[model samples]
Target: MKQMTRRKWLRGMFAGGGVTLLAACGGQPSGETTEEAPAADDTAADAPGVVEETGSAVTVTYWGSFSGDLGEAEQAMVDAFNESQDEVVLNYEFQGSYEETAQTFAAALRADTIPDVVLLSDVWWFNFYLANAITALDDLAADAGINFADYQPVLLNEGVRQDTHYWIPFARSTPLFYYNKDIWSTAGLPDRAPETWEEFMEWTPQLIDGDRLAFAHPNSASYVAWLFQGVVWQFGGQYSTPEFGMTMLNENTVRAGQFYGDTTNTMEWAMLSADLNQDFIGGSVASMMASTGGLAGIQESAQFEVGVGFLPQEANFG
Candidate 1:
């Protein structure tokens, strides 16, 4: 992407943090995507007899994980910024996904070649903070006269550490339910997704049968944690302590575990081993809990009618 002033970009990010999606305490995508356009183009220098101070050109390197069309779109925005003015030259580089970008960043930090700006996923915010590798941009904002309140509190909460802000929120994502509408209707059910947890359970058995599962794709610590969050919250429980130094697997977690175990083992309406994309596309599963980022890709790939709904809510208290 075009080179933007590091301080200036930080200020913009501070004010526009909501544009980026934070990691939904759950991993399912909630149909969120990057919504903000590229940062405003720098004004032309020497316009209308305004004397432009010519100075040494500076190079600002940016690293991100946006591949395919996403990468192309990102580059287009960067190129616009780069060509907007004759001041700083912004250099854009793609380093794969968040994990790959972070790995490259780690190497740069070790070699003292860290870029002028970097895009970080929400989960890594604390890691960078704890490692003391990220630069705080609070005073940078103050100098630029940007208001911080324009951003979402969640973004600020994740970005700020030790009274300073380092990374700016760039892309945000959330998790939601994806269902097969045709299958539901063919199964003699309404052409609608379930709303309450009771309704979901009441429909799963009827919607699924031999050789097909209602749900799939569990077993990862990340996804497991995501699924557990909904149930744990429904049962008034927490996964860890406030300090995040302790795990809190109370009765709620136990109950949640039993519920899931029954679904995959006893009920057989779900698979414990199938990848979500494959099973979802192959029509092997009726519903899936996935990230919002996958929607476009799935839509392009799915052969059957797809529908979306909010995750079901439990009807009864624990």
Candidate 2:
């Protein structure tokens, strides 16, 4: 196996947050005690008991889709936690990416191997909650002395069903604007990005001439849904009810559809691409909408000058 570098190890460790290390005694008698053994025993008494375990050792089997440098960072977190204090031992498992982790947990719940904790994509928390696969941590929170008021109410909210807090908000991401400055300058556009959605739509036409697309992929329902929500809110529309039972597809929905659909249909600004990064790097795409997590990756991979901005919105939604 390839060895993870020291820097990568440190990064992975902090990123994953839950990590552990175990130490072994070398041929010492079972009765013999190390100087710190008493402290370790005391610490173990306070930790949460693992579902599969009979005793104090909390083997928190966590699955995540942390790959590449990010994966290494998570491994480092695991190793650090295991080496920390010997109270909770986190057994890290690489199930695959965020989507894969969700899928794996879905399948695994049918079996005997139920993990104590699982990392899931923030959006997909709904699926887990709907299926009743995740434990409601409200009582756990109370027991642990966590006050919900201490955090942002919106941030703490995972898509709830019927007034039940199914999953505590884990990893979160927001949309962002990514543009190639070189492409923009070459195309004789403004130095900075458009401030409004209308402005952006208008600007797209002048940027593209032939097969080169003004924007990247436009196929992802998730991405489109996000934009639709944001845009509709900009124009004053409620996406879903507080109970989330009914979707309000009013005039705002029609406007959102028209605006988003025009990216490919009317404006011809975007290409129907799955390999957005490829198109961007190849200089075929001038700009794109991507997740906040993609910032570092885009910066590292793109050869051209990349500019970042908040997701484009209407004039006065906020």
How do the predictions measure up, each by TM-score?
0.76, 0.76
Q: How much lDDT does each candidate structure score?
A: 0.59, 0.57
Give the per-residue lDDT of model 1 (tens digit) for 121-216. Answer: 654434544455554566556655656676677656656555656645565555677888878888777776677666778888787878887877
- Indicate the TM-score of model 2: 0.76
- lDDT (tens digit, per residue) of candidate 2 on 204-290: 777786888788754453344554466677766656676555556677656766666777887778877656566777788888766
Instruction: Please report the candidate that would top lDDT against the real structure.
Output: 1
- Taking every candidate in turn, the Cα RMSD to the unseen true structure, in Å, is 9.3, 13.2
RMSD (CA, Å), candidate 2 to true, equals 13.2
Where in model 1 is the C-alpha error above 4 Å? Answer: 1-7, 10-55, 162-164, 218-231, 315-318
